[model samples]
Target: MEKASSVLAALFGSREPAEAAATVTSIFVYPIKSCRGISVPQACVTSTGLDLERLQWDRQWLVVNSKGRAYTQRVEPKLALVDIELPMDAFKDNWEPTDLSYMVIKAPDMEALRIPLNKKCAAVDDISVWEWSGSALNEGNEAFEWFTKYLGKPSRLVRFNTELEIRAVDPNYAQGYKTLFTDGFPFLLASQGSLDGLNELLDEPLPINRFRPNILVDGCDPFSEDLWKELKINKLNFHGVKLCARCKVMCLFVDDTGWPWSVLSACKEMSGREVKGCCCREPLRLLAWAMEMASNAAADHGCRQPVSLVLRILPLLGTVPCQCTAPASASAAACAPLSCFIPTINQENGVTGNEPTSTLMKFRSDHALKLKKTQGKMFFGQNLVCKESLLPPRGSKTIAVGDPVFVLQKYSSNVDAPI
Candidate 1:
């Protein structure tokens, strides 16, 4: 009992047993849209999204091009390489910035850029992301030059102007909720079980960062989040608005290589599993291909890992060779090389291919939407809109890593649409 208590305390910072069906396993706040995320033990759940008190709020900042359009990993894979950091005390609710306080930004071959936390900025209108357009505060010349050199194009860093704009969630989904520079919803909730189930169908398992979920939960059945219409954590209620349709951004390589993975190819092959031992054999080939692709991409980026080391790991992965004969029961198409199905490199973005999306389409597509004659899409996570406190002094709720998640209400079936 003592040992178990120690382990629980180590993982969640509290030894209390969960009293709900699920526990919040992780909390991530992306201060800047599409940049790296900061994992926190606890965060204030605000009207917009998870926030680190006085330091930064989720998606409060954005990188924009010369035309004031947003730049995301989908357009510039190099954004994945950009890193953001803040002082440790910044996460505290009461921490006040001293004269030395700064938000440090770093990227490859670029000197660290520091922006004072208390610095004032000029508000600029014309910044836009996805379907929302509004005014935002410009971070100034230093940030401008830093991003321009890193992205190799005219770029600027802008903060969403809270005082000037109110970007509301689509009325068709959540009537009155609002968000900042997020792709759409304020909160994206994912389940560890869902990721585990998806990883079972993947060649190399992906990290939770691939989904960029703000709230990640555990101790739930795979895909159960899809049916979560309403849930609560701490003192806040979160309603599932739309089923999050994954984009190419999640397929981006999670390594320093800056190469995109073939999610389409991965999903198509791993999801099908039509051939006997396809999971075992095909994955081996896919692993080798990914390694080689990563190696080549590294070389392109002027950084290369030892190919010999990659080869050494290959033998440990499986004895399966690139050349393998399919069983009699399998179709001829099943035996074709993955490269034949799709070009190994995307000509437009230099991505190797696609996965999970192709696989997800087989089983996870919205059947209700399809029946309704609406354009159907494959979904992985749930888009959430918080039901903030109606009383005075709103956005005071805080959610922690070990907080128990209660399902207040849920759909009987995932096939049913929330709207």
Candidate 2:
């Protein structure tokens, strides 16, 4: 406790009392939905989301089916294998892409496809993502044929028509806040401390990519973003409106081959390459195993308290397991230290579950008193809506790595409150 206090004092020596003293550690922008992300040193904070204008904006493009429905990693795990890139200079402000400038896309067993950055096409109507159904700019027949061939299905690449459509965030959360093609809010912010905390419980630690956060921060305690109702970064205000609910996409195996586990066997059969190390895709059972592992960890930690209790206790201890000495009474046997046992679960190839998501549910579930009204769901990061969008003279706001983060306001009760 003394060591942590000294560290905090040193860290916050230059910050105001209201600030949490965190800093931006990383920023990522997904050019295409359910595809690989590009890490940038800085990104323009737009009303819709992160943008580089003529280069790439987060989720500005979507891959749709013949029915005009969006295809994501959920339904098509192979989309994880799709790699997209643009010129590094494109991320610079006011950088323009010439006629020859293109966004190159590559996939396993497919030729590289390059689409002009400024390419325009006739409006394709009835394209849908979640509840929003509207017209979008088609990426031409060549782009369509490429996706169809790569995905082994009828697919079309369509760009969002920002001028014609206004997709509003749910009024119940943050009124008038709009997003491009994100699941809900414009920005998702996560804490590195939270990831490290969860990683301690997993047999194999998962990367931040699994959560797909737009902004990643460090130097704060685990899950501190949950209590942050309002914050400022790079002179722009960001309001934490809701907790980010996770889905099955995080459980899918993303290998170096960029291919999902489901296609490895087929790739082996066709290409006759050695496919010995990859784990089989078990989306359903993996989630179950992750939950079971977390439950077991909690049980073996010498305490069987509810998740909310543990969360409430985390801030004081700077750790998960209780730090009390071993109990002497028979009735208090459950109060033992977590170090008493080592988890024997093998994670190399025999492991059946995904980490972080499975463990996040054990502590960040909606069953807590402060979150009970929400639907039963597992949460990780905080969904943010920039206040600049709601203010006058809205202009491009830039956030870069190492920018100081200040918490201006917070919820009265932590999400860790007991139910």
Candidate 3:
């Protein structure tokens, strides 16, 4: 096995040993399987994993049978192609700081459904949703009707309840806590260099979306993220729990419409794994295992283990191959063009990209913002107290209240005001 330090040095260009510490640049969670992700600036680290306003796994909204057993996209490859939208309305009055509102799923046909915020409903017929524990869920009939109508197949919706007490086997040999329905672990990490490397290996470059990772880190060599056991980026810290095992999903091709299986044969040939799996399968597991061993090595070396990596936050520049640090003028220049690229509601000048209704509710409450609909326009307010005209849909438009929205342009407003 390669020495972890040597591997790190090879992955990222030469850096001072002290300067090469691991850090988390971004955190993402998908509340529903094969749907969009909710990206947050910061999250609380827990024993179970990241706590994003009580939402985890990202695939908690599942299709199950009358017996309450769960189903995955693996058996129904079409499930991987669905899209979901969580509108802003679901997060209205009942919003809590910790509550996740709605979830949305998009079908292969591109039709979208916004599930209600409520968890209880009727059960679907003949379809049971099963968790990792092999226990069946009672996803109500209403969910089945909704899914069957949209999916054009017999399916039902199920939610991973905190009450179910599902757990995964921790590598440390401790009992794990209940999870919302992730693939099989607490965290997924991906390296920008690794993706870039793979793109170089392929005839054409693929988007990072194909990997569906929970974390994206820059400044590391290709595949170096697999060697980290604990990493701290700015103020965020990550304790990598286990290796994320890969499956054939990585080789599944998603066309412009996001449908898979078009290039499975090609991927098999490319990976030389006709019966083994896709590229993401063994590679992901190998990376995870390497990180765990690295952490153990660091501990054995008698080095002080730091809690969470500390990172100095930087503004996002909306360009391919984005640099972590950039000038204010550059940042503003990058953001200025976003308004014309996105559709917006004229009232509050808010721009939305197909968010699920329930998750939107949690977003509003956590940020203390109110999203109101007026004459087909969506207006936003700060705690229903101070309402401001919606700004143009610049790249900054995606920044929510609780998020650390950096101002790239200088303004003469109250310098002492809280962000």
Candidate 4:
């Protein structure tokens, strides 16, 4: 196993640095937790790793369960359907974080959830996000009830509390750095060249949104980011921290109302009943076959024959254990790979169950490129931390789309990291 921090040393390999400077192609920010991100023409850069009061514009808000545990698309796949819209037009005056008052959040069948942003607002401390826990402004029961209704669970909204807390970056990677609700670092960066290279190998090409990088630069060879040690986008200086390890969250079926996870759940329920028929009949073989159909319906978008459900009802049936085998690497282990949708059974109960089944819906581009080239870890982007002084003191400084990007470091191989 790899360290909790920079696990790329065993996997990501070396590449030649591009002589040509890169261009800023796109910048995206996700104001709401696990929802769709909006591309910005320009974003105000802020210091994250330091003990700054608060960092804004990134993952400032988060969704917490009853226990205050963070919820992401990994568990709530429909989070992808929640639309997070920024108040760009409100920036007519000063472009500082204070200028923004609220963000509009909308989901399917529900009225928009509006939450105000108060930089000086007090917060509820000890909100858990993996190993590091910190303070966050509890967005109140109205926000909680709205999320609980949509997610079908006791979920609430919390914003990062800059007034009372600062999260440090992993010491293994960098020191004195802090990011909000992000998995690790403050910024995630990728290049157009890498995407083009990946698209060449995939049967279904993915948009840049699928990877969810903070900065998308043009030019450079495929996977050039793997070798970047230091960089400067316009005036902001950054240290390349680590190669990101991607999970199934990157490959989700984004829909108008989150991905139709609920719809698939309904499909499984409806199909399960059709197998049991009107006579309380259960053909042992038909029951087993029907479960397969449900799993398929949950994984694939294509509709299947309802005949599997309506199979001729037979009175003869026996309850049998349904076993789902783990991949060779995780044999007998609990979790499955990103590409798999396996159900686990408890020996004591003979009942089988699983979390919502997920498949590689987007980024069908070659995993061989992302998964193999960077190590079996599948690094899709670069995590960056910037110097505190580099950020604008007040308001916003517009960085045009075609700004020049300079690699501040000289050519060298990484000692702690892999090829």
**lDDT for each residue of candidate 4 in 140-175, tens digit (9 for 90 to 100):** 877889999998889889987766677776878877
In order, candidate lDDTs are 0.61, 0.60, 0.35, 0.54
lDDT of 3 by residue, 41-102 (tens): 54333222222222223455666533444434323344444555554442232332223555
Error of 1 at 401 (Å): 0.8
Displacement of the residue 264 alpha carbon in candidate 3, Å: 18
How high is the lDDT of residue 107 in model 3? 53
Candidate 1 lDDT, tens digit per residue, 270-330?
4332111221112232232222121111100111212221100111111133333223222
**Which regions of candidate 3 are displaced past 4 Å?**
1-26, 34-57, 65-69, 87-101, 108-111, 118-131, 134-139, 170-178, 233-237, 247-419
* Tens-digit lDDT track of model 2 for 1-419: 99978864443232344555699999988888878778899887754332212113888889998878777654455676778888877666556779889889988789998988877678899887765778888999899999999877799999888778777777888776678777667788999998898788877776777677889999999987878877888777777888776531233323333554444444345334322211111111111111111111111122222221110000011112222222221111121111111011121222223455456557765654247454334567888887767554454567889999998767777553221
> TM-score ranking from best to worst?
2, 1, 4, 3
What's the true lDDT of residue 278 in model 2?
14
| Candidate 1: stretches off by over 4 Å | 1-19, 47-56, 247-352, 367-376, 389-391
Candidate 2: C-alpha RMSD to true structure equals 15.5
The alpha-carbon RMSD values of the candidates against the true structure, listed in the order shown, are 15.1, 15.5, 21.4, 12.6
Instruction: List TM-scores for all candidates, in order.
Output: 0.68, 0.69, 0.46, 0.63
